[model samples]
Target: MTLGEKICRLRKARGLSQGDLADTLGVSRQSVSKWETDSSVPDLDKLVALSRRFGVTLDELVCGEGDAEKEHEPEPLPAAQPQGRQVLGGVLLAVGLLGLLLFTLLWGLEGLLLGLMFLLPFLLCGVLCLKVRRRLGLWCAWAVYLPQQVYWTMATGITWRLVLTTPHFTREMNYFRLFIGWVMLAALVALTVATARSFSGLRKEPTPKMVGVTAVLWAAALLIWRLRALFFGLFADETGLIQLPGLVTGLLQGACAAGQTAALAAAITLTLALLRGRQKQTPG
Candidate 1:
C-alpha cells in the first residue's frame, strides 16, 4: 500500500474523517484529502503528530505494510540511533576498559574490586550512551554509582571506627545501606527495562499506570533483597563471609540481578522487535 492508503486506513480505523484529521493536524480539509490521495505528503511535524494521535509507531505509520522485507533498512541504526551519542558512548567504553586494564596491570589481582568501584561510572555511562536514545547517561551513571559508594563505604566500615575516637561496630548503618541499596537497584532495573523498550521504535510516555507498575516492581525487588541474609547464609561460609561485608554482598547481588534483568529485558525487546519486523514484511 502507498503511504496515502496507509494514512487513510489508519484514520478510518480511528474513526476520523478528513476534516477531523485536518483539524487535529492544524491543516485544511483539502490538505488532508491531498495527503489521503497521495497528491502530497504531510510535513515531518504533521507526520509525527499523526502517528501520535493514531497511537501507532512512526515506522508503522510511514512504512508501507506490503513492502518486501529486504527492501527495508537494515538495523535502522543511523536513523534510530544518533551518531554523536554512539561515538561518545564508544569513547567512554574505551576509557573504562583501558582504565580497568591499566589498573589491573599495575596492581595485579588485588585491585579488581577497586577497579570496579572506580570504573563503574564511565563504563555505565558508555553503555547507556550506546543503548539509550535519550541523553540519560549522566542520570544512569549516578543511579548506580551512588549506591556503589554506599557499598564501598560499608565495605570499609573500618573507616567508621578509624574516624571515631571510640571504635565500635554498629547495626545503625546496616538498615540504611540495605534499604538504599535496593532503592537504587530498583531504579536501575526500571531504567534498564525502559532502555530495552526504546528499541521498539516508539517513545514511552509516563502515566499513572506506569508509576504504579514501577512501584510494584520495586516492592518485589525489595522483598527479594530483604532475604539476602538467608540466601547468603546458605551458600556462603564464615571465611568467605568475613572477606566480603554484608553491604558489599548486597551490592553484588544487586549487580547480578541488574545484569540478569537487563539481559532478560533485552531478550524480550529483541524478540518483540523481530516480531514487528516480520509483521511489517507479512502482507495483509
Candidate 2:
C-alpha cells in the first residue's frame, strides 16, 4: 500500500478518526485528511509523532514495507514450563498471613457476631472477584447465608434477655425476629441459585456506565439505611428494639439493602453484556 493508504488503514484499525489522530499528534484535522488522501505529507517531526501514535515504524508508515504485519503479531510463548503452581501457593500463603495479622490486630472485635456482619460480605466480594466462573459468586453468596443462620443461633442470648425482661411478649417477638432472619436466608439462597447457572455469564469487564450506576445505587441504599436508622431511632422503646413497627421496618430495610447490593452487581454484569454486544457489532 502507498503511504496515504497505510496511514488510513492503521488509523481505522486503531479506531481513531482523522480528528482524533490529529488531536493526539497536535496537528490539524485537515493535515491528517491530507496525509490520508495523498494531497500532502507530514514533516519529519510530525511523521515521527504519527509513527509513535499509530505504533508503526517510519519505514512501515512511509516506505510501506517495514513489516507492520509482523510487528502486530502476538509475542512467542516461553519454551520452559511456567511456575504456575508455585506462584499460586505463594499468593495463598500471603493471604493467610494477612488474615492472621488482621485477626490479631482486631482483638476487641473477636466473638462479635456483628463482626462477621462486616467481614462476610467483603470476603464474599473478594472471592467473587478472583474467580471467573459463576460458581464463585454462588459459593460466596451461600457462605454469607451462614451468617444469617447463625444470627438466630446466637439469638438464644437475646431470647433469654427478652424472656426475663418481658415474659409475656418474649416468645412472640423472638419468633418474629427468627422468622425474619429465616426469610433473609431464604432470599440469599434463592438469588444464589438463580444466579449460579448464569454467574459465568456476568464476567467483570470495566465500563464507565456500569461502574457509575453501581456506585450510585450503593450510595443511595446506604443513605436510605442511615436515614431510617437515625430518624427512626427516636421511636424505639426502652429495649431499643423499636417495638413491633420499628423491628419489622429494620428487618425489611436490611432485606432491601441486600437486594440492592445484589441488583447493583447484576446491573454491572448486564452493562458488560451490552458493551460486549456493541464490540461484536464493530467490524475489523
Candidate 3:
C-alpha cells in the first residue's frame, strides 16, 4: 500500500477520525487529509509523532515496511454463535420459569412482588452482558447485580440500623453479614479495575467524559446517602401526613440506588462501546 493508504488504515484502525488524528499530532485536519490523499507527506518530526502515536517504529512508518496491515487491523469481536444463542435462551427461560414456580409456592403475591424487584436488575445485567459480549461485560454484570442484590437484602430487613441497634442479634450472624458486605465491596472494586483496564486496551486512554460522569454520579450518591434523613424529614413534613417518614425514606433510598446503578451501568457501557468500536474496525 502507498503511504497515504497506510496512514489511512492506521488512523481508522485506532477508531480515530482525521480530525482526532490531527489533533493528536498537533496538525491541522487538512494536513491529515493531505497525508491520507498523498497530497503531502508528514515532515520527519510529524512522522516520528505518528509512529509513536500508533505504537510503530519510524522504519515501519516511513519505509512502508513490516506488518502494517496486521497492526492496523483491530482484533475481531467474539460473536454469539447460533448454538450458543439457543443454549443461552433456553437457560434464561428455564430460570425464569423455575423462579416463577418458586415464588408461587413460597409466598404467593408478596413473593412475586419481591422476586420481581430483585430480578429486574439481574435481568437487565444479563441483557447488557449478552449485548456487550466481552469479559468486561461479565464484570459489569456483577457490578450491577451485586449492589442491587445487597439493596434488596437490606430492604428485606437486614438493615445496618437493625444490625447496629439489636442487642439480641447473634455475633455469628453479624460477622456473616459483615463478611458478605466486604465480599460485595471487593467484587465491585475488582470489576471497576477490570473495566478500566479493558477500556484502556481498546481506547488507549481513559475517557475524561466518562470519568467526570462517574465522579458526578458517585458524589451525588454520597450526598444523597449523607442527607437522606434530612430529605426524608423535609418530604414527610411537606405532605403533612403521619408515618410518612418511612415512605419518604424508602423512596429516597430507591432513587439513590437507581442513580448509583445508572452511573455504574453508564460507565460499563462506555467501556464496552470502546471495545466494540475497536473490534468492529477489524477487517472481515
Q: State model 3's lDDT.
A: 0.60
User: Between 2 and 3, whose TM-score is larger?
Assistant: 3
**Per-model RMSD to reference:** 13.4, 16.7, 9.3
Q: Model 3: per-residue lDDT, tens digit, 1-284?
A: 77888788888886678977875664558888999999998988789989998878888877877775667466453233534644664565456557766886799876775565555555554455444333535554664655564454436423222334445656766666655545555555566666555444333123576557646765664565556556555655446543454533454575555455445645564555545545645687
Deviation in Å, model 2, residue 19 alpha carbon: 1.0
Candidate 1 at 192: error in angstroms? 13
TM-score of each: 0.42, 0.26, 0.50
- Compute the lDDT for candidate 2: 0.56
Q: 222-247, model 1: which lDDT tens digit per residue? A: 45434645666676666655346655
How well does model 1 score by local distance difference test? 0.61
- Candidate 2 has its poorest 10 consecutive residues by lDDT at 155-164
Off by over 4 Å in 3: 1-86, 97-109, 136-140, 150-153, 156-173, 202-215, 235-258, 261-284
The full ranking of all candidates by TM-score, starting with the best, is: 3, 1, 2
Segments of candidate 1 deviating more than 4 angstroms: 1-81, 142-150, 153-219, 235-284
Listed per model in order, the count of residue pairs whose N, CA or C atoms clash below 3 Å is 0, 0, 0
TM-score of 2: 0.26
28-146 per-residue lDDT for model 2 (tens digits): 57888999899998889878988888778888788876676754554343112124433443564456445645765776445333445445555544544444222454655655654
Rank the candidate models, highest lDDT first. 1, 3, 2
Best by lDDT: 1
